[model samples]
Target: MKLFVNSLSFLLNVSVVALVVGGATGLAIIRDHQERLPSIEPLLDYRPSVRSLVEDSEGSPLLSLGKERRDLVSLDEIPEHLINAFIAAEDKNFWDHEGYDALAITRAAVRNFGAGGVKSGASTITQQLVKNVVLTTERSIERKIQEALLAFEIEKHLSKDEILERYLNEIYLGRGAYGVSRAAEIYFGKSLSDLTLSENAFLAGLPKAPTRYGLDIEQGKGRQSYVLSRMSLENMISEEEYAHALAAPLLISEGDNDTEQDQASHFVRSALTEVESIVEDAGDALAEGYVVRITQDSDLQGALEKSLREALIAYEYRQSAWKGPYKEDLPPVDSWTATPVLMDGDSYFVSINGEPLPLSKDSVKFANRGEFTLAPGMRVLVEKVGDKAKIRQVPDVQGAAVAMDPKTGRVLAMTGSFTQDGQFFNRAMDAHRQPGSLLKPFIYAQALEDGWSPTSPILDTGVAIQSNGQNEVWRPRDHNFSKSGFVTLRSGLEYSRNSVTLRLAEAIGEEKIGNLFEGMGIHKKAEPGLSIALGSQESTLLDLVSAYAALANDGVPKRPVMVESVSSKDGTVVYEPEDFIDEREPFFDEVTLAQIRSMMAGVTEYGTAWRAFEGAGYTVHGKTGTTNQARDTWFIGFTQNLVVGAFVGFDAPEPLGRGESGGSTAAPIVRAFFDQIDETYRISDYQLPDGAKIIEIDPDTGIPFDGGFKEIIRED
Candidate 1:
């Protein structure tokens, strides 16, 4: 009996020794595996490809562009209930476990085996974080081992809160939202701090399947109820709170997924193009979370848009005889849907869907004297404003306007078209059209440099130039087709006399004028012909405005600055406006600029643009441009503080109408814009340069006269 007892003790002792040895060997293997895993230190500094933001000069976000939208939040900012909700839904034993949950994994294994598929994943928050950060979704045992090993290593280096924070931010929530903060905005249109218990539960339920749960509220409700039940069962939430949350209705706010997309779209597009030109690999830069600051004034932009639309509508109404929609032309009361086709002045052209409706005589009346053509599939809308039916065009006639700061060359307001929807072309900088008489100012500036004062007289008689190859003779005549005998240069420009301008160009040499035009900022090579003097060179509104701004800045040209600066996510300025002031020697003498400016003032005071600003209460130096047949009309004007340019024309060049000259057409729009300016911005007159002296001069020969009449001349 004693020998058997001793043998049993020895066997038990041997069993204990073997168990200890095996357990130690297993622990060493795990430690070695953990050591072999990649370090999670890089994850501590991990940053996702956040959306790039475009801001206005005032620091208001104008737009954001990217595939993923994320706003990072610290763990402290996360509410305790929010964290508890996620813990209950994803991992109840998250704090207790190092990297994984053994019991949950065993239960999931059995369930998956029973179902012959992956019914559930028992990954802890840390394990999930490791998978998202470093591992793929592959279900192989090798991948699972790697994931487990990485999670253990991560837990050793990072705290529970750190793991939770990273996991919350790295997970994808639907609608291009990647983090809780962004998801909060996407789902509720509110910040994370503003989320209610029900909203919190809804978000907590999304990690399982964000798309399925995010899109359908019914599906989300089921998962949300499960999450709330789990929270209650885990004591994370009181039973009363759980009940209240479960009873709460799911109210989803409208997602602003595309809100930043189309607002100020034309300006945004232009800014993006400019940014791309400066930053090579702009896509990568955007992904790295760059911020672009542009010089767009939202208030001014809104006003500019409204003014352009109103001006076009008013012009169309004046030109057209159609008062309103005809009763006979109207569709049946119910069948006539108030579909908006095109905006004509105050009326909208109405039509029924899928119906063929001819434009009534009322609608065609605005059509430029037999120049209106309506294509098939044209749409219109009609609405009752008061007692009359008003018709409007869907995509109204297009136009562009640009306002800039002459000192800094900053574009304060710009629009590519009257409406941002239909056409995507940016007319402000991209549309290269004939400047018409807008080029005349540069020619006159050249004349000033050549010692010709504003009162220099030129013959306004018929001038003929033989075509180089054709037998046709080009005889330039005034708009009135009558000669004025002789007129001062200022008078010639104010009246836009074609004959006077052509003769002056002949005497000064067109090539010299062309060189001066290039020096002033007209980028295109000047057209070779006597007609070039009549403003026939192709230039963009931006270039033309900048050139005029040079004159406003006293002969120093400033490159138009659309983007003020660009910064990266780390707040490093990547690009800034530098060397934009053209220092290639002064193109025009200060006295010449001052003299021309004074002469341009005549255009607004007593010339073609007179009626437009008769009682405007302030003086503006400006020039009016009317192309041949009035295809393009322009008004480039400036005060001491601002420079604004407006253009009206058809996309396909055609005569606007019989009397739609720049003075009568585009000048009125400019006047309407200035009328809206606050009194503080209004400047009564430009400060004359020191070298210039005002003296009484004879209007006929531009020679000094002792009479009371006064003119500005350079003291050479």
Candidate 2:
């Protein structure tokens, strides 16, 4: 076959010229000047599109944002074996060829003639570089000739190393990476020095068809084998090295940045939104190659995400329904094997791959809970936890959460929605849902500032008020339907009694409460009605958290900000948010803030949310708000230094279950989230300011009474 190909090489060359000159002249039209070709100056002064790096508060990479993720490296920076591998795989005669290889072109032409079509490409590294940078990726004869001529021109201007460097730095290598250096991070999660022979070969084989071979394990290994054999045949590697590489296991990195960003999609997107506003021009932040410093604590963000997902899934499992299988299709139940890991009789752990994937505890306990036991092949959603993997599910019920530092108003972490792929609408900031009972604290705070004390008695029985229509009367009752007739103002908020709150609002009138709500930025306009007392107004989760931030920060509300600063790739300060954290003025006076916080503390103590945090070992002052029929449930709580708001509901209003309220649905989520947060912020008892009095009134008779001998004569 070689002798016959050599004999026909001349005929093929002649046929190539005849076909090119006669049949495909339109592809390569004659030009008087070389101006038709792009200049090599741009290649000499190369600046590939670099991805924006998003780092956490500690300067650790949380995610990357860009169109083409690249980490630029010079030819000298790349390892010698990697260069050898690419040369051996793509073009071993790269050093000898001027631009296009005549022998390779002749062979490719002969094969195309026999096959009756353009079957292959014989572009050397230089020609490919030209096609990638200067010319369109058209496969016609004109584009081909233009590409070859342009490659020859580039060869005259640039050295072999320069051409190879540009090719290596600019080629797309799958996973949104556009260079060998970035491909190393994406495929191996390490620098080139740490890449093994098998891993290096795998990357070397990806340029031909990155999407096809990079993702297909079988095809990737086959391609890697071919590249390895070429390297061996080209004397790039010894026989022993080739055999070892062939036998060595292909250790693919589990922690790709895209997937890592996906794990924190809500946070990454939220951070990028602020980053865009800060940078100049700010149209395309990814292309600007900015280094963004975000306020997200990865540890806190991870905890909130897991707890939120678990709480949502647990809510799903409690209902007497199944929200279909993962990916909307069940696994065949015959392919993969998963085993439960019993760790020291406490934490529950699970695994996917024994060698690569790390095991995560408490992520696979769904099977251990109900009758749906973990069979060997049962399909379940699994989340990649850094180096480990865990079983999980995407609950149909969507929700959002925000964790803020009440002291600095720095947004520690926030999630827009349950991160199912293809879901981009952020619920954390944009979701305009009714605050429900979460507004009780602010309501009582306004009332406290308006001459009503926490001990002020309010009739809890049903009261009728005028509605919008003529002679239309609106009667509001307690949420539990069972009224206490008369209860302390504190008890009204503690029990989340709708009637008591309405009575208090009626006494204080809508003007004062409306002004207070408006000041909290709950809404632009406040309505004149008693329903607003029961939180019948829409507000964002972030606004609600900020309102609670006042209670935690001595009545001062700190503005929630995501980005700390942004810098250019050259380390220049592009932009930094001046209002990153300001707003030192207090919304409520100290007395009102202290009194209202004490009343809210009663909520988790023995009121509606008691069962959720009875033994949580954390003192959380919060209110539970459940919308009509449990469509939306909210629990916005705060500690001495931290404030967190949790929301759980379907995208469109759907009933959570038969008996799930904010206390049952949302407060437990808050507890789960707080449970995972580090114990840096400690919960403390609310201190009543001067001139504040707590008078316990009898629920039956609305009369202040003290214990006969224990509490009658209390001393300060």
Candidate 3:
């Protein structure tokens, strides 16, 4: 018996030694892995990514778009009822536990042991914070060990409130919402403070399995009931509150139910872009939370959108052509007779009882065109509009429009692109297309400042100019290559006489012309060439309108602006419109302004744009521009108060057909835009300056024939 006892003791000692060695190895490995974990220093000053809001001047929300739709909030901002509800649902002993709940873990372990699988995680909110912020949610013994150890470490550094705040802001609540603040908005369309007991319970129940809960609305409500029952059982909420929460209906937002998006996607995009250029640190605007105040007037914006859309659709209708009908026979029509009139795969017809009639292009009207190439088995969308079927396809043609308060330099409305993705490109300010004849007024104004009068005669005959002094010469001529031998300076601009403009550029030194173009910010350091006088220099629509705004503003150039101010989430003004003001001295003198205004008025009244604004009761002053090959057509019209312009053309810079002109295309768009807002917008008339007199001139000869004024035709 003594010998057997000795052998057993020896075996026990050997086993003890082996177990100690194995345990030491495991501890060393775990220590190494723990050391390799990410540092938690970033959480010390965490700033959740918040959606940057674009607001109108009156502090109304216009847009709130971002990558992660988060709205960071402080622990104090969250209500006590919400906090207690989360605690009951997630970890009932949250306030009393030191980084972890021992009793809860024991119970979860017993439950899992009985189920023979991993069923529950008794992770405290502190542990969840470490998991979300500093570590991944990897399901492994090692990861859980690491999470628990990190939880203890985090609790030592951050207070209870800090951990809760970070957890609330960093938790992913599904539906692209990253935190409680945005979750309230996404699920209920309410602010944090505005949430009811029922709303709070619904949000609190989403932390564990947001995606699963989001999939089944009833399942999500069941989770909310569980949270509510737990809250009531824990005495976190009264029975009455729980009853009301259970009774309240779940009102969730249809992801992307952001009303601001529906308000003005195009303008919001423009404002966001402008915000980027102005805001130095992107975090200051989005991550740190800011409200960007833009100069948008909703009424004007609607009008601009309506006018641009209708005009583009109309243009597309005129330009559309049926590539070919579907190869298969079309369905039977009610009244039409179609007895298979096709012979050589040229056409198809519906069967009818009457005569065998062939289908003609004009027999039935095409409601939509210029978008698709009709082919066999094509699924055509047909909508009956009175007696015609109207289909929808985005046309190949694109356009842009802009409206501004000329005096204040505030951009009221802007529609950048007409395509479905209107925000893809800011055609109003970014597209630097050739201004064409719209540039004539500035050149004429420069001439008048240089001792030239309205009657100063310039030869409008053809002129040949050298290109880089090479053998290739540029023969500047009219739109139709039609030339008038000689014309007055006034007539030169009023008619957009390209030949006359080239002659004036030659008369005025090329260096001064270069200065004039560059100084106005039209084109940068333009090459010394007369071609610039013919609108060869590419300028954004906004820059051209701003130049005309100078003419309307009696010389002071007020640069166009979109964002009026930027404020912090706390409503502290960080950026003001005054900071962006480019209040430069008038680029043109009063006399130059008067002469140019007079000439532009003539252009609108009796020139290329005469028919567009013919009977416009109020005074209208503007010019028309049509680029070579009709690639771009523009019309910039303005009163003393407002400046509006638009450009219509293919995005690929192709011809928009032969007959399309600025007066026929873009002028009417601006006219349509003004017509909608005519009741709201009162265009102020241009007044003569002190010591200025009305000078009468013969329309045909540019000679002062009489002192009698024939309409608004006084030129200095």
Model 3 lDDT, residue 188, Cα? 77
TM-score of 2: 0.60
Encode model 1's per-residue lDDT on 291-355: one tens digit a residue. 88988887777777767766776666655433332234443233134443554554334444554
Q: Which 10 successive residues of model 2 have the least lDDT summed?
A: 707-716
Per-residue C-alpha lDDT of model 3 across residues 423-466, encoded as one tens digit per residue: 43568877889889888787788787787877777777778888
Candidate 1 residue runs with Cα over 4 Å from true position:
1-49, 67-259, 262-264, 320-391, 467-472, 481-484, 698-707
**Could you tell me every candidate's TM-score relative to the true structure?**
0.60, 0.60, 0.61
Index of the highest-lDDT prediction: 1
Task: Report the lDDT of model 2 for residue 106.
Answer: 71
- In model 3, pairs of residues that clash are 555-586
Winner on TM-score (2 vs 3)? 3
Per-model root-mean-square deviation over C-alphas: 19.5, 18.7, 20.4
- lDDT by residue (256-338, candidate 2, tens digit) is 64543334466666666565444422322333356778888888888787677767767765763433224445432222333
The predicted structure with the larger lDDT, 1 or 2, is 1
Ranking by lDDT: 1, 2, 3
Q: Predicted candidate 1: what Cα RMSD to the true structure? A: 19.5
